[model samples]
Target chain A: MPLSSRPVSRRTTLAAAPLLALAGCRWGPAEDGDEPAAEPSNAVPDEQQVKAALQAIADADAFVKDVSADHVGLAEPLAALTALHTAHQALIAKEGDTGTTVRMGTPTRATAALKAVRRRELGLQRTLTKLAGEVSSGELARTLAAMAAGVAQQVALLPETAKDADA
Target chain B: MTGTDALQTTLAAEHAAVWIYGVLGGQTSQSSQPALYDAVTTAYVTHRSRRDQLVRWVRDADEVPVAAEVAYELPNAARTPAELKAIGLQVEQRCAAAYADLVGRTTEDERAWGVNALVESAVRQLDFDGDPTDLPGIDA
Candidate 1:
């Protein structure tokens, strides 16, 4: 018998059957078959950015808590600040989940405290302004921009204290 | 609406802001309060720059920018310093709203521009003793 005419071994055929089956599986339909998964209509794409905004809101709240009556002329601004931060917290919480705990800055003298709060508001506004440009969702972009502007307004409202105090 | 339309809207608001600041500055300058006069002057210049920038943006988009209204409705006569400040704050609030809308309607770089404008106007409102709100531009 010619060498080329030899029959295939039984074990080899069995292995080849499984190999061909495995090759066939590569072209199979997706796990969902013909149907595609439905995307969440209002899912937040940037949860981290949203959390950062929440963190800013929490920091503002902490500053308000740290302030005392000794702050003098800042009483009304501080009170208004508190009201706005509360509203911001509510708005951010509506967008995504936020933790209640926040790292509190050490309390400082009146002037220093107002200045520190103003700096914090400015920082938040800057951050959100940048995020507003980058966020993919239109609604999220609008909200972030508006929040930044609101913080800017708060920064302007902060009392002007001429005297410097030690923190 | 397209980004150009939003920019035009923002340009209109800037026009109003600049005009209102001029009126406020005139009122403040006539009064004995130099400090208020200086503040209004600085704010007036800022609004003027903003209006000019918006005009440039509209021109770059190949659109004819809308002109400022002959007269904007004042919040009141604004004879006193307090009244002037109140009217200034109102102008800022309206400008903020317009910028916020632009932020929503524009894309990428233009959206960022809107964001800065919104922040500027909102902060200006604070100068006039306006209380902070959750959303500066958003109506309650």
Candidate 2:
């Protein structure tokens, strides 16, 4: 959707009082001698959240790579996840951090490997969701939240196994 | 934008969503398309709840909440199940964008609410056959 379609902006041109009234206590002009606001100590730095998310994606990618290599038959099913992680890396990764070459060991059996992948994906989803809430930047939080939701869509489409039923 | 402005934008989207989903539910048949009917019904209920919640938030902020239009235009006639599903996807995509903007323009509890709304709408798009995208709300 076009940004112009935002209702409040359009309404502001017609009438500004009610919307301005909503600003209330929060809205104000800075005084001439005022100092800049300090960063909240409790807030997670954006760089930290981004780095953590990138590392999680890298780890998940490594695990998927090992599992697919061990079980060639599983490659097709895992390709979707690989694509998702790669796209996410492009969006959130910094220049030097994009190259994550960590290798993870795979389970002996294909079923066990698939189960492990599912668990890891779910864990990564949770990590992203938590990071979304804790990050200092609102835009980054939105991106992280959307990433979590994308993982959720993939989780929903995974083939249901006996172990998955327990999960 | 301020938090209240973001809330109002989201509220406006919810108004359109609630109206659109109601039309979609009416277009679907319970006997012939039970699954679709159920999805549409669920979407309608969810959008209605979100709309009401947005109204409350805006009112609490001491602003007059935007009123819902008397009617909303459907993307198409939506006579077939396929058409209905398409409209459903459109409604959710729009809402997802709105929530994404809300997330960027708010903070604390309000931003958290926007994050949840964005996630829900992204998942809801899957019900209408949307592929799992890398970024659910970002235009890219």
Candidate 3:
């Protein structure tokens, strides 16, 4: 699907249009404090949003790791993210899961997945920069506590909008 | 779902679906039932517009879009009025679920569009099924 989602805010829309240019690019947050990343807020979000986002993250991660990755450069991170993606997808759909399926490839799915994961990691590193260090959803301490997930799943590779930061 | 192939396939499905809904919704000339009929018509147009938008996007990206099938395998043989609505509702549900599945596979930006489209389909399905809240499960 062209995914014709409704257009987002002007700020984010301006930032998102040039993503392909940054596909191979890298950036680091400001030193003393990650200025680009938000100072984590202490406010809580709707439980439903958290649950939905968690589930959505699962599926998104799968896309990164599932396909033939023989041509990719990193295997371990890819495999790990693939595992995490599947787990998140299952959780979003509200289903229990088994272990991740390992897809064999020429270059090894691991390398590409790792690079993808690193990109996501860097993205999040800058993103969480804005958030206050300590926060939580509902009565929990943080997203992890709110999620209370057992599976070690990697988060999403791309932000919904470059404007969303970590999400 | 985030794969180039998967996204292209989904875009193709939506293209055909929008066209089919257009013809199916339009063939019925129940103007007397204005509210109901108009709803169907609007859904068809909305989907069709979305289809065109998607096709253009695919072309712009130098991607091959899915071709329309000679004929769709309707969820079932919808003969009577009730059957037509049933089939229509089923198609919408499947479409909704398909998008929901994509919500997981693609980037955040991609998922936002999916969420909107899914909601639009779900609303139409609810109208057809008489229960706007009910939706099919994801194929995970």
Candidate 4:
């Protein structure tokens, strides 16, 4: 027999299987007719994602925490909004940009919606910041809720954000 | 939104914080009440540092984060240290929760920052509220 026609080696076959496994991930059960399993829907949005957004917002809050008493001032909500637009843009894009995968699939539309919400949040952040500066009567308290709510509402729309993000 | 989505939420929170501190500081500065001025100024410095870090964070992410304006107005007359501190505490609590909200919602790689943020805000609130036990990293 020609050298080219050598018999199959056990070591080569064993090596091949592991390499194949390494190259691709398998979803679902092996017995399910060889196709990967389908992913479940609506796992609650990750808390970490929410936490990060809040943390970023907190950093913004930290700035204004004492502004009211400082006798200093600014009107930069619009600027804040613009910066937010620039800052998180990648995460906003990445959460949805990748093709479907296990964890990566989670953010889906929620990411985009948050992108919108975050943009709004920036506006609100500034609006509220300015309001905080101008805070005199209890009127600020009254108006603050609406602005905060607007941001929260957008955050509240995370489910929607996630949907489009996943879709 | 993903971890970054939650991160985005923090942007507004930090904005709120910056506003609160700025308001309190300016009001106190105008009054020039010694004790109140010191406290409010301290608070403002804290907030300003926090704000700058946030801005840097946003920038590090390669996003177009906003810049603080030349000035903001004071809503009411913040004439006392107590009043300014109250404002700080209130806003800090809110910011803490905001970060906490994220901690509860996200997972994996994003959780670390969220938790760190929660700790930061909670500790800050503790300082403002004068209850060390209210959060971690404070002694009895």
DockQ of each: 0.22, 0.18, 0.01, 0.02
How well does model 4 score by local distance difference test?
A: 0.39
Give the candidate order by descending TM-score: 2, 1, 3, 4
Alpha carbon lDDT at B29, candidate 3: 53
> Candidate 4: where are CA atoms >4 Å away?
A1-167, B29-39, B60-62, B66-76, B105-113, B130-140
Number of the predicted model whose TM-score against the real structure is largest:
2
Query: How well does model 3 score by local distance difference test?
Result: 0.41
Give me the runs in candidate 1 sitting further than 4 Å from their true place: A1-44, A63-79, A94-96, A100-114, A160-167
Model 1 chain B weakest 10-residue run by lDDT: B131-140
Per-prediction share of native contacts kept:
0.52, 0.42, 0.00, 0.00
Predicted complex 4: CAPRI docking category:
incorrect
**TM-scores, in order shown?**
0.71, 0.80, 0.44, 0.35
Interface root-mean-square deviation (Å) of every model: 18.1, 9.5, 15.5, 19.6
Indicate whether candidate 2 or candidate 3 has the larger lDDT.
2
Best by lDDT: 2
Worst 10 residues of 1 chain A by lDDT: A19-28
Candidate 2 residue lDDT tens string, A62-139:
788778888877777888998988777767765555434456577887778888989999999889888887877666
Residues B1-140, candidate 3: write the lDDT tens digits: 23344356456556556655665575455765565567667777776776676677567668777676666556555545566677566656555544544443343344445545554665566556534221221311
How many Å off is the CA of B133 in candidate 4?
Answer: 7.9
- For candidate 1, lDDT tens digit of each residue in B1-140? 56777688778878887888988877886458877787788888988998898899899999899898898888699898899988887777767766776776677778887888778777677678787766766531
Off by over 4 Å in 2: A1-45, A98-105, A161-167
